[model samples]
Target: MCKEKIMNSESEKDIKISKRKTSYPINSELLDYLKSYDRAFKSPIVYDDLLRYVDNYPILDKDENDTFWQGVIYGPQEMSEIHQNLKKIYSRLTSDGADKSVDHLFVDSVDYCTFGNSHPFRIKIKNQFNDNHDYFYVKKADASRIYGLEIEYILSPNRINFLVFENTLVEEHISGIPGDVFIEKYLDEHTNKIRLAKEFVKFNERCFLRLLGDQRSYNFVIVLTPDFDEMQYRIRSIDFDQQCYEGKINLYKPQFFRENLDYVKFVTENLDESSIKQYQHEERALMAKRMIVGKSRLTKLLRVMKNDQIAPREKSFQLKTEIFELLKDNEVLKCETMGDIVEAVLNFILRNYQTSMTKLF
Candidate 1:
């Protein structure tokens, strides 16, 4: 859990992140699972190697705002070698370790971020010939984050591409406008707001069902698609460090966050309770279908999780009890681990996807 505090008595609601969290190492079982699923790769460069930067400078966005990233500088002797290895690792993540596609790519910039639990190093690679650029991240491996990424890939509509090395993790960047920026700049400009509203409800439901927490406005993104008639919107989570770790029930629900009050307002003003319930039902049914398709993989992953220590025992027990009160199901009460709770919740969704959504509200 993020040693954070939420003040619901004051204004609307406020959530603040505290200092460092307890680090959980990747156990043997999770490593085996990654290797079996081909998500394990041997990278020539590890996370500690990137920490050798001799100096760093603060970075700024085009709008002259702080981007919360530091432009890392490395010694000339080590810079060339590190960038080359990073490019190759990017190749493995994108093309299953083929380097032929990356001969023209050059590392443009390397930046380090201290904003989240991962404290990841972001690499920007650009095509020398066409100037087309892309990004990937290198971060210390944590079992909780790895589980979040895997579950999101399997259950969510978005596709996640990532790899796990010994103590390192490599992940492709999720492309979209940040949720906070979208809400601030574009929310008033669009005449057709119903599509975004519906997507928000589904997005809210998706996070709660999967127990993904701390999704304030900035933790997610908004992807806009051009439909035949109107614009279609999809909400995606960019950060996955808080997966099933928080003790509070409202923390898993995005609608309860203070930063997301604007979105909550939009949802409440435009969507009726019945419409919201219908969208929740639709999202659950879709998840049930996905679960059926990814049964084998999900089963193996959950088995590893059931025996793993992703969160403190006290927190898990608290969340489990809270969920049991809502579900009135003995299965949730019988859960001894967060993994078991997740598995039971999944079974509940499979069994009551169409009928039990009424309890969600």
Candidate 2:
């Protein structure tokens, strides 16, 4: 009986080892979980440090116009804490077999006064972080507000300050908002602004398909580089924590590019037809292929998410549904050229939406 029991225990051990070998790696496991839930798992360590710094900093008494004196830097006490988090992330990036240090991969210029509660910073890396360099959004976790994480990114590396603000253009309420009104409210005299916004939404649809969440307006910015005598606004994502989706889900659709017609009309009215066609082509070319995952891997991962007994909630659920209803006719996204995307990016900047309360009628 003792001999039989020993043999059975050995067999069980072998099965467990085999399972471990066949199971997904730890990094992939965590990434898959985030994708399944449509959530960006912000780093806890970074969030804690940011909180500590913000807590001790003395609020500035100056007026809002003095953006530079906002006292946005993290407090002195948080220096050590921030350092620790940076060290940890750096260690991971430069671990035994890692390709490069995070800093070497991207230039780091920090910012503390982001619109979001979390502190924001600029990351200037070459070769685009995973072919996503144009712009990416990332979140650092916190126990406080659910949207406690910060959203930020630079549109291009060659600019005055690559760290530009990305305004989500959506209202703060999170629910009961109309998408067209939001854009109209922020629409600018420049025709390019509307075109840029539309192109951005189209690009965003790609992100949604990958199971990445929180593609808020404030999460990214449009960059305009002066070429010869002309100016062009390009779209780029700043945050990247959610780029690697474990699931193989594709949410691409024509409506996503055309659902909000009012906003599109508002934007296109300011542009020439030639530019619009150009943006349409650029969007299509980018969406033609999925470069991030292999067929087998994507298939297996998406299946796991589908099989999991979980129901996910919308991250920006508080936004007014009435406004989003306007998202039903987004004609701007249908453009087939970079010109439309450029027009869209520029139009928003021209609108100067943050301080505008003007009557469009």
Candidate 3:
């Protein structure tokens, strides 16, 4: 039997609804920021164009299980037009409008998912010469998701490449083993369980500090890399729809998710309170350093985010109050939007860093 008995804590139960009802539209200021950063482009195609597909079939995984994806098929003339436009877009994304590099590439399949908030279409491109393949996503652009992508690019260790054109957002695929699959298949085989636990601690801290939410096991992936002697694991969030939209503070922390109980159990079993605190501090320091390095760009983005509305007032107020209660700092109480909450968190980190420095003098 699998060692799945470790997730029995009362706190492991699902506490809040995980889905968001509506997506916030991208506003003007955020659009300007995207345009300024070369993230906005003009495209011959938009998200609605893909909806003209005549038929679709259920996409199945290797085990013949329905993957919640439909293989979209368009008529010949429409397919030709779409394939050409998609190739051009792919060139723009990867080669800065150099179409010759992807001349030999062809669109293999387009898969759409209707289950989630974004309702993204997954595009698969393959090289005719060597049959090498790559994937990308085309989704209707949402302000919250855009902010999440930018924050992940700036604040996290990973760099993401994406572009916005009108209502469509194109995201480069992030490759990794889905977290649930990793927990089911690789958890027992992983030699360095402590490192895995440490990574989860850091990931939890990162998500909470940035106010990202809904990071259940299915929403993120675990990447494994071979170190000189051992393996290193990194957990990256793939779904960005729920970024900073929840009322409860615990929603921002991945450890609170029932689907991630295994990871939480790992941390609780292998790490003591002191170690967890150290990991959190370490992540915070790294984030602070990243902020310093990207100060100009980050500040500009935050300004746009602060002026934009991504969540309801009640949700924002609840989050602000919870943050203040947690820190015993009332500054967050003045935050009006989700962006303001994020700004308050950043400022709080800076203040803590400065105080620590002053103690050394």
Best by lDDT: 3
Candidate 1 residue pairs in backbone clash: 92-97
TM-score of 3: 0.95
Q: Candidate 3: minimum summed lDDT over ten consecutive residues — where?
A: 1-10
Regions of candidate 1 where Cα sits further than 4 Å from its true position: 1-12, 15-19, 354-361
lDDT by residue (tens digit), candidate 1, 139-204: 989888899999999999989989999889999999998989997778766546677878878998
Better of 2 and 3 by lDDT: 3
Selected candidate, larger TM-score, 2 vs 3? 3
- Model 2 residue 143 lDDT? 16
User: Relative to the true structure, how large is the alpha-carbon lDDT of every model?
Assistant: 0.86, 0.32, 0.87
Off by over 4 Å in 3: 1-12
- Candidate 2 lDDT over 1-361, as tens digits, reads 1223222332232211011111112234434533443333223253333434353233343443423212334655565455444433433322432334434343232334454433443222233356423212222322111111111111212212111112111011112223433454535565366546455434444443232333333334455556685445544443333322111111111122233333334333444555544544444333322212133433444333333322112211211121124233233244222222222322332233322424543
Give all TM-scores, in the order shown: 0.93, 0.38, 0.95
Error of 2 at 331 (Å): 25
RMSD of 3: 3.1
